[model samples]
Target: MKVVVAGSSGLIGTALVAALRRDGHEVTRLVRRPANARDEFRWDPARADLDERALRGADAVVNLCGAGIGRRRWNGSYKQELRDSRIVPTDVLASAAAAAGVRTLVNASGVHYYGGDSGDRIVTETSPAGTGFLAGLCRDWEAAAQPAADAGVRTILLRSAVVLARHGGMLGMLYPLYFLGLGGRLGSGRQYVPWISLDDEVGAILFALTDDALSGPVNMVGPAPVTNAEFTRALGRALHRPTPLMVPAFALRVTVGEFADEGILHGPRAIPTALEDAGYSFRHPTIGAALAATVGRS
Candidate 1:
């Protein structure tokens, strides 16, 4: 199938593009600059400019384009930036894909859509959206794809969790601390950290594109959920370090304000119900195994 992926330079996008190419699928990347002679195309979501002709023959369009949530603080301006960065690009892409008559549109959402503080309850795709900057952004982000949906395209809304890998994303921020023996549980150490390996995340995206039964919201997370303390322990074990310190939630708030309180230090248990129901298997189901595989400490 011919697939066009936005945010092709991101961690997930890089992995997905490589996997898709390895499988002999024709992949096109959407860039911000003008289209070059290469396989890359151009689209400026802020200006609502896109090369619709490049997407004319696309069988599937995966919109992974978005600003990094963990890259900065959630200030008033940054908050708007975060929201617009995801929604605007989605709106532009969806409109183009719908007009081009694309068959499948897979848009990215976050696990925060289910809210940050989930206590112990399990969340599935059918659950109602939570309230917060991220949840609101995700709600609006997914809603931007309505044009494709109305065009009878199979749209998959991926509610991805913290994607665990070695080089980029969340791991890069935590690896230094873990390697320094300062990594440990956040806050009271009881909050759930719903996570998925990088491989599983890419695989799930491919699976969703091929599976016709999948549409709407799908949680891209591991089967087994781990508490904050458990994740700290597992990561420490993976690095063979003594986790002797705990970053209290109050300290985190004092340091990074609401962002640390909401996005970084807190999360709920999100299970991939739709993926499992679609008969997709997970390579790293548990946190310990995932950490081992990621750090090459096995």
Candidate 2:
């Protein structure tokens, strides 16, 4: 199969490309920069310009293009950037795929679609989207892919969780803190965190592309859901360090500003219902295993 992946420089995108190559699939990276000798294609979602011919013969198109939520404070401009970064590219990709008659389009989404707070109420594919800026952003992101779906393309919205990888994503931000033995629970430490290993994240994306039965939203998370406190403790244990400190909610808010309140310090429990029912196996379902993998520990 020939696959075109947007956001090819991102953590998940890079991993997904390698995995696809290993499985004997020809991969094309949708890059913003100039193309090199490798399978690189040009695209600028903000400008509504892309190499449509590059997508012509592709079997699957994975849209991982988006601004990083954790990259900066959730100010008004950043929020707009986040929304634009996701929706515009997705719209372009969907339109191009529809025109090219692509078979499958796996659009990346976040668990934020489930709302910021679900309490003990477990979320599924049918769960209502929460009312917030992030939720609204996710809603539009998924909606932007309507053209591909309308074209009879198998469109899968990957609602992923906090991806745990050594090189990037959440793990990259937490590694130095953990290594310094300053790691602790965020906020009140009771929020349920839905997380997935880097390996499983890549696996799930591939599964979505291949599985004809899967469409709509699929939670790309691990089977195990842990509290913020438990996550901190597990990660500390994995690193053989003490997890006695707790960062106050107010302190986080003061340090990171609004993002500390809405994003970093708050999250809900989430599980991958579609993956489990479909018998997809996970390499690191638990936080301990995830931390071990992040630190190169068994």
Query: Global CA lDDT of candidate 2, please?
Result: 0.86
| Predicted structure with the largest TM-score when compared to the true one | 1
Task: Please give, for residues 62-169, the per-residue lDDT of candidate 1 as tens digits.
Answer: 999888887877789988888888999899888888899899999999999988767789989988888877888889998999888998989999999999999998
Which pairs clash in model 2?
Answer: none
TM-score computed on alpha carbons, candidate 1? 0.97
Q: Please identify model 1 stretches exceeding 4 Å from their true place.
A: none
In order, how many clashes per candidate?
Answer: 0, 0
Misplaced by over 4 Å in model 2 are: 296-298
TM-score of each: 0.97, 0.97
Worst 10 residues of 2 by lDDT: 259-268
